[model samples]
Target: MENAFLNSLVVGAVLLGCAVFSALAGDPDALFDFIVPPGVMPANVSANNFTFRATKADFVAGKLIVQKISLAELPTLDGAGVSMATLMFPPSVADPVHFHQRASELLQVTSGSLFVSFIDSLGRRFDQKLFAGDAFLFPKGMLHYQINLDPKKPAHAVAVFGSSNPGIVLLGPTLFGSGLNVEVLHQSFNISKETIEKLVAANTPHPL
Candidate 1:
């Protein structure tokens, strides 16, 4: 009984250490991924899975285009803990305010310029204008956005993430388009019911 208790204590301490490390690193995937719990095989074992290619469509431009190459698109990246996305912002367009759940993003401007900003947990906002070859880091789980300041040309960038499955949570869509009750929004934002409904209607995605 004493031996069993000591083993359990060690296991508990290890788990607690992992949890604290993951929280500090903003990488919850580390807990299960690093230890390689039972039945988990090594990623990208097959030679064919070793390569990834980006095509023209990946860089296609739109209002606020984001073509991501995450674990969902490449199963080989399942254990890699890394992913990338292409960003194209059309003239005067802006990427929606969003946050990555699992990974911080490093956005590097490739062409044109962009106005970038992020809001920290304390609600303090930071912003800057990034030109070609400039980069910005958005801390994990912080709300961030970027806008193409050029009036006639589009801006391009690439975002590198530290997690294979970095999940995006868009503020507008989450708030207005998720069938949230009108009363909830009205109370939260102190906005009129009509305005809230209009926002919901505008943000709701149409069946494609």
Candidate 2:
């Protein structure tokens, strides 16, 4: 009888030790031999380039500052022979005629009115007026501009440059300067020589 009582006591102590270990483990299946605990929670991942909505208070001086989440600054990108700038044009603002010689640009308007114009190598011009949720793609080496149409409210658009570091080559700057003779354009584009001369003359002294 003592032996049986001691056997029962040993069994009860073993079960109690298992229960205590399970309580300390903080999982229901801690005592189970085949059950494994899950791993830790994952870290939150964000974008290299992203934009979140800003309230009215966020807009200062008619411009809403969108965080550039780019990996590096514009000049660093330029030194690698590429650069991109986050351009924010307030209402009724007009951007200069620009082109990316090395890469294309993709634009998406998150809010307000945006007007885009582009002139192709063949001298064909395309203009588009977009609203709050519109997007456009501009081909590389083409002249393009973005303007805000609304006079009272601001417009916000995001431009993703194709190159790791892309630079802008203004169209007039190339045509007017660098000793690119006007006659070449007249002969290539099938425009009148007089017209070409007049155009070059008008665009002389291009702005930086």
Q: Which candidate comes out best when scored by TM-score? A: 1
Q: Write the per-residue lDDT of candidate 2 for residues 1-208, one digit (tens) a residue.
A: 9999999999999999999965543213223222121231223222321233333435456553544423244212322222344556677776668886656778888888888999998899999998877888888778899888788888777777656434567666567554567678877789898887776776756443
Q: What TM-score do all the candidates reach, one by one?
A: 0.78, 0.49
lDDT of each: 0.83, 0.64
**Clashing pairs counted in every model:** 0, 4
Candidate 1 ranges with C-alpha deviation above 4 Å: 1-45, 58-62, 205-208
lDDT of 1 by residue, 82-192 (tens): 899998888888988889988999999999999999999899999999999999999999999999978889888999998888888988888898888999999999989
Compared with the true structure, the alpha-carbon lDDT of candidate 2 equals 0.64
